[model samples]
Target: MENQQQTWIDLAIAAMDKAYVPYSNFPVGACLVSKSGKVYQGLNIENASFGLTNCAERTAFFKAISEGEQEFQYLVIAGHTPDPISPCGACRQVMVEFCEPTMPVLLVGDEGALKETTVGELLPYSFNGKDL
Candidate 1:
């Protein structure tokens, strides 16, 4: 992995440490880099209701968007799974809303295993605002 990717993975792991996972105990973290070079970190926050839980990827995107960072450069998601972690459907849709189709996304898993992909690759034929 490249140095910057490693750094993002490390940030995601650090963010994972702060996850609030009282139910499933599956902690996930995300690191998002904006076109302006700002970095945002987020972790999953579970709710007892289950349906109200917020994913780490969405948290990162929301945080950046709330702060007026629209254009994204990269995204990194970290988890303890056997393979690199994949974003949930909701998170993929959110990415399609705010991120460029070619924006890079990096998934980090156990032992620092990494998978490189793009937003469009993660959600093919996605539904976006243009379809509305």
Candidate 2:
């Protein structure tokens, strides 16, 4: 598991290098691992209107879903920040929609900093279809 996480982190960093950050200058990358061992990667895209921006996590999820991937095993997020950054509430909600509550989420920062958590742990009592 550690090795896999490291590999995914590396991939996420590589993807981050390709991000388009004109405003915030904070690039983020995300890697989604499918149950079938497929990896989908994405980078954050920032637009002039910050509200129109798309986060790296959502980019990866959208790509994977578009490719017909519904089930996922784990995810890795990489950024250039000092400490590893957790996904935003929107991203967390998206995870709750698609990923299992206990699915592993590895957060990696520059210089090899890393932290691990799960969707359920990140957002307890998340709102879902059952709550509606």
Candidate 3:
């Protein structure tokens, strides 16, 4: 699976170059692989109002959903950090909307190292509307 993970890492690195981060300068990139074998990429976009910033993960998810894609297999998140970075709480919650709890999430660091995990493992008590 290293080869496949590398592919995603490459895509994410490419996407990071497209990020519009003028405020925080913290660019993040993400790529999601749909169940249909389609891949979607996203880059963090920031605004003067910090609250308006859109995370890389959500950008990918929103783009995929907008294209009528639903089912997802895994997602890769890349950042220019030494260690693999995890998604923020908001991004994790948004992922729960479209991804299965078992969906794999690969966090890639700038050193090309990877940390493999699942959405459920990241957000065990996710509120997926099952109780609502």
Residues 4-111, model 1: lDDT tens digits: 877888999999999999899999999999999899999999998999999999999999999999999999999999899999999999999998899999999998
lDDT (10s digit) by residue, model 3, range 30-81: 9999999899999999999989999999999999999999999989999988
At residue 119, candidate 1 shows an lDDT of 98
Candidate 1 has an lDDT of 0.94
TM-score for all models, in order of appearance? 0.97, 0.96, 0.96
How far residue 14's Cα lies from its native spot in candidate 3, in Å, is: 0.7
What TM-score does structure 2 among the candidates reach?
Answer: 0.96
Stretches of model 1 off by over 4 angstroms after superposition? none
- Over 1-132, each residue of candidate 2 has an lDDT whose tens digit, in order, gives 878877888889999989999898899999999999999998999988889999999999999999999899999999988898788999999999998999999998888888899989989999997888
Please say which candidate is ahead in lDDT: 1 or 2.
Answer: 1
TM-score of 3: 0.96
Give Cα-based local distance difference scores for all models: 0.94, 0.92, 0.91
Worst 10 residues of 3 by lDDT: 1-10
Which pairs of residues collide in candidate 1?
A: none
